[model samples]
Target: MKNWIKHIVLGLNYLKSKNLIHRDVKPQNMLVANNVIFKLCDFGICGTLKDSISSTHLGSMRYLPPERLGNICSYGTRSDMWALGMSLLEVSQGYLPLSSESIMSFMSHMKNDWQPDIPTTLSQQTRDLISILLERDVNQRPRYYNDILSMSSMTTLEQNPSEDERNLIENILKSLPIPTPE
Candidate 1:
């Protein structure tokens, strides 16, 4: 998980430096290469940031941040952080975090500042990162990938996945269904 997060942060940092916003950031949009390297793909809805804000509302509804839903113009890299947080939460817990039956309920939950309960099984560093990434206030959330990369929670992490993590990843990859050409 830490390795995955590191690669994603690097990708986001590059995009941020280019003034680009990858509007869609979900598990499906992430690709694994050689069963090791992680990459973000499907930039169909990517947009350019103007004055640190992106006005267009285009992204998967489930992955979008509350600010984009409430006010399209009131979003930037902070919105991407929210989506990234949701993705991390899903990956960590093996399930999607939010499950509102209807859009109205989801909107209500967002307006109410609903946040996923961080699973205690995760490391303290991972939990802290998730909490900060999912902060309700956009201003409080990390606006750039560096903001997260520079955190003490992230600073102590190893740059590469450990042997145990590599084994676990290998096992998970081996268990996945192979795609059959259409």
Candidate 2:
């Protein structure tokens, strides 16, 4: 999972460097191949950063950033970062942070001050990283999440957690909408 996050960030870096923004990012768009490497897919809504016409609602409603939903102003690479954060949370916890059945329900769930209730089992570093990525205030969100993930502390995942711990983590991961390749 740690390496998965790293590769996702690396993918984002490559996209950003090329002045492109993938307006949509979620677990469905991520494909883990060969039981090891992770690849990002779905570029139907991709657009150049400088394109104002591309600022419209072209991405998944659930994965979009707050600014894009409520405001008319254009977004930058940070918007994609927000989606990345949401995806990271899902991949880490094996479930989406928010769920709604209808459009109205979805909008209602995205209150201005809303924050996802993160699980208690996550390490402090992972929690902090997700919080930073899911920050409602766009300015407060990390400008470069890859830097945060590359931190030594963030990479210190247990090589061999106890059987109980391993089972618990596996259970969480199995609950995700996307199946983990075996």
Q: Which candidate wins on TM-score?
A: 1
lDDT for 143 in candidate 1 is 68
Computed on alpha carbons, the lDDT of every model, listed in order, comes to 0.80, 0.70
List TM-scores for all candidates, in order.
Answer: 0.88, 0.77
lDDT minimum window of 10 residues, candidate 1 = 66-75
lDDT of 2 by residue, 1-182 (tens): 55566667778778877877778888788776534456789988888866422465678888878887776446667777788888878766667765634765665566465686766777676677778788888778767656766677547745444454445446656766896899
Each candidate structure's count of clashing pairs: 0, 0
lDDT (10s digit) by residue, model 1, range 1-182: 77788888889788878988888888888877764678999988888989877777788877777777777455588888999999989877767766634877877787676877999988888998889888887789886788788877667777667775587568667878999999
Candidate 1 C-alpha error for residue 50, in Å = 1.0
User: Model 1, stretches more than 4 Å misplaced?
Assistant: 171-175
Mark the regions of model 2 whose C-alpha exceeds 4 Å error after superposition.
51-54, 154-182
TM-score of 1: 0.88
Q: What is the number of residue pairs that collide in model 2?
A: 0
